[model samples]
Target: MGLTSTASASSEPYGHYYDEYSTVVDVTDVGADATGNEPITPVLEELRDDDTLLVFPEGRYYMDEQFRFTGFENFGVVGENATLVPANYYDFAGPQYRLFRLGVSYSPGDRIRFEGFDVDQTAPDTGIRTIEAYAAERLEVRDVTIHGQHDSGTWGPGMFNVTDPDGTGLVDQFRAPDGGAWINDTPTAGDRWRGPIGIVANQNEGTLEFRHCWLGAFPDNGLYAANGNGKIIVHGGLYRNSNGANVRVGGNGSEIRWPTVEVDSTRPEDRSQRGIRIENGRNITIHGAAVTITEPEPTSHAISVMNTCESARIENTRLELQGEDVNHGIVLSPDCGEATIADTTIAHETAGGYPFWIQDSDRTDRILAEHVTITGAAGDAGGFRDGIRCERNNCRFNYVDIEQPGRSGVNRNAIVNTANELTVYESNLRASQHPYIDIGANALVRDSALESSSGREAVCLYASSTGPAFKKNRLAQGIRDLGATDVTTWANTYE
Candidate 1:
C-alpha cells in the first residue's frame, strides 16, 4: 500500500509516483538500500539489463563507485524526486572518479535516456561526475540538476557524446549553478589552475543539441563542446564566467543562438574569460546572442573569431565590453576565412581597445561588415587605435556606422585601413581626433559621410600610397594628401 516491494514489479501499478503502464524495476526491489546508507554500485551491477527501465523511487541513492555499462540496445534510467549523493574522494572506491559511465566512445548504447535526478556534492572533497552518456544514436537527457560546487576535482558534472555519424541527441534543462574550484585548491594533486568544466562533449561525432542549459563559473572553461567533428547547436542557454572562453565551440555547421553570456567575476589565478570563442571550425554562425563583459583583461573580448576557422558569420548580435582595461569587442582573426558581420552593434566602453579589430596577419584577407554599428568611449585606447582597425585586403563596409568619440588620443580615427584595396560605401564615419578613414593604396570611398569632430582631415593619404578614388562624399575638413600619386576625387563636398 505504501510502496510496492514486489520482486516481479513489472507493469504493475506502483503508487501515484509511477503509472500503471510504467514497466520498471525499482532499485529497492532488487536489494538496493534507498536510505542513502550503503553503496548502490553492487545493486546496479546485479540489476542492469538491456531493453529495461531502472527507476529509483523517492530516496537518497548513495554511490561510492562508478557504475559502468556499455553496448546496450536500449536503456533508460529515471528517478522520481530522487537525490544522488556521492562519497568523498578519500572514502570512495577504485578510481574514485565518476558516478555513472553509461557508455564509452567505442561501445555505446543505441538508445539511452537519463532524466530527472538531482545531485548533491556539498561536502569537502566530494565532487564527482554525474553522468557520462555515450550513445551511438538517439540520446535524451533531461531535467537533471547538480547542486553544490565541484571541489573534489574529479571530472565535471555532465558529459554527453554521440559517437556515430548518423546519431542525434538532445540534452534539455540541465542546470549546474554552483560551478567548481581550481585544481590546485582541490584535493586533486595538480598545479593546474583550472579544475573541471561544467559540461563537456568534446568527443562527439554526431549531431548534438543542448537547449536551455545553465552553467556558472568554473576555473576551466564553461560549456566547452568544441573539439569534435560533429555538429553542435546551442540554443538558448546562460553561460557565465570561466577562465578561457565561456562558450567555446568548434564544429562544421555549428550554431550558437539566443545565449546570454556574461563575465562579471575574476579569480586570482584566472587568465582571460572571453565571451564567445570560435576556436576552429567551418561555416559557424552566431546569431541573436548577447555577450557582456564587465571585468575583463586585455584578451577578454566579447567575441573572438580565431585564426583556424574556415568561415564564420555574426548577425543581429549585441556586445557590451566594460572595465577600465584594454578589452576589445569583436575581433576577426587574421587567417580566418571570409567573415561577415551583419546587423550587429558593439558598444566598446573600455579604456583602450577597438570595437572591431580585423587583425594584421600577413596574408590575403577578405571581410565584409554590412549594416553594423560601432559606438563607445574608447578615447585612450591602446596604440591610439580607431573604432575599426583593419589591416587586411579586399575588405568592404556597406551601410556601417562607426562613431567612437576620442577625447585625448593621437590616432582615434573612425576607420584605419593599413592594407590595400578597401572599399567604403553608403556609410557614416565620425572621429574626434584623427581622420575619418586613413586612406591606403587602391582604396575607394563613395556615397558616405566622413566627419572629424576635432576638426581634423576627413581623409588622410599616406606617403607613397597610390591610386585612390573618392567620389560623392561629404568630407568635413577636406582631404589631407601627403605626397600621394594618382589621387582622384569627384563630386565630393568639402567643408
Candidate 2:
C-alpha cells in the first residue's frame, strides 16, 4: 500500500483505488457475487500475477465467459460502482467474443491498468465486445463507459480492440455511445461485426493516446488506426454519427490534435459519412479540425487524403457545409504524395463539390495551398461548384481566396487549371460564370484578383495554353486567347 491516490474521493459510493505492490484482491472477499447473477469469471481467474491489485467494490458484475488476461506484469483493475454485463451473443463463449481479453497476441506485457468501469451493453439482440487488449507495454484505460445498441449481427461487439506494438498507451475519459448497425441482416459469409469500432488501435507499435474521448454512432470508424507502425494521438475528441470516417489514419505518424467531427443529417443511413480519413499515411497531421457535414446527400468528403499519402498536412482546418449534397472540401487522391494545406477554411452553405480537388493522379506531386479560404453559396441552381479543381501537377496557390456567388454553366470554374506547373499568387478569384482563370499549360497569374461578375472571359486561354502568364493582374473581364501561343500579358488591369 505504499502507492495511494487512485482518485475517487467523492462521487457517491464508487470509484476508488490504491496500489503500491501490497497486493489487494477484494472480489467480494473471495466468494464473488455483486448481485449480478453469480459467476464473476471464477473470482477473476484467481488473481496474483506479480504485483496484483483488483478491486471492484460497488455492484453488478456478470460476465458469462471470455474474460481472459494472460501473462501479466504489474496488473491493476480498480472500479468503484463497477458494472460489466455480457452474456447474450448466442450466450457467448466461443471464438474469442470478448468482454475483456487483455494482453497476449504476440505476448508482451508490462504495467497494464484498467480503471473505473461501466460496460452495460443495453442487452436486446446484444452482440458484445467491450474490450480486447494485447501486447501491452504500459497500457492504461481510464474512466470507461460503453452503453448498448451496437446493432448486433455482423459478428457483433466492438468498442475497443487495442494492440500495443512496442509500449506507451493511454485512453482517458472514454465513452462509446450506442454504436451498432447492420439491422436488416447480412454477415453469414465469414461473420464481421467488429466494424462499428469506437476506439481501435490494432497493429500498434507504440505511443497510442486518445484523451477526453466521446465517440458515438459508429458504423465503421470513429477514432481508428490500421497498419500501425506506431504514433497515434488524438488529443481532445468528440466524434459523432459515424458510418465510415470520423477520424481515420492508416497510422504512420498520425496526429489529429483538436477533433470535433460531426455528421448527423437526420441519419440518412449516414450518407456515406466522412469527416477525416487519411489512408496509407506517412506524416499525417490534421491540426485544429472542426469538420461538419449536415448530410443532405453527402456521399463523403470533408477531408480525404487518399491512398499513397506521404507528407500530408492540413493545418488549422475548418470545413463546414450544412447540407444540400455536400461532397468535397479537400480531396487529393490518385496516389497522393506531397501535400500541405495551411491555415485552411473551406466553407460552403450547400456544397456542389470542389473546394480543392486535385485529381488526374499521375502519382500527384507538389500541392501547396497557403492561407486558404474558399467560400461559396448563391442559390444553387445546379448547386455552386468549382473553387479549385486542378489536374494535379506541381500546384501552388498562395494567399488564396476563391469566392463563388452562383451561375457558371458548363462545368463551372473559379480556378480550374488542368495541371502543368500551375501557380497563382496573391489570389482572390471571384466567379459568376466564364473562366476566372481556366488556363491549361505552365500557368501563372501574379498579384491576382480576377473578378467575374458575369464573365465572358478573364483568362480562358485553352489551346494547350503554353507558358501563359498574366502579370500584375486585376482583371474584371478580358483575355480569352483561345488559340493560345506563348501568351504573356504584363502589368494587366482590365476593366
- Candidate closest to the true structure, highest lDDT: 1
lDDT of 1 by residue, 188-274 (tens): 858444788988999889999999998888877888988989999999889988878889898899999999999998888778888
lDDT of 2 by residue, 5-77 (tens): 3443344232233435446566777777888897687778766456777778788888877767777677777
**Residue clash pairs of candidate 2:** 15-80, 128-157, 150-180, 154-192, 154-193, 155-193, 166-205
For each candidate, what TM-score against the reference?
A: 0.93, 0.41
* Model 1 weakest lDDT span, ten residues long: 13-22
**Model 1 TM-score relative to the real fold:** 0.93
What lDDT is reached at residue 410 by model 2? Answer: 31
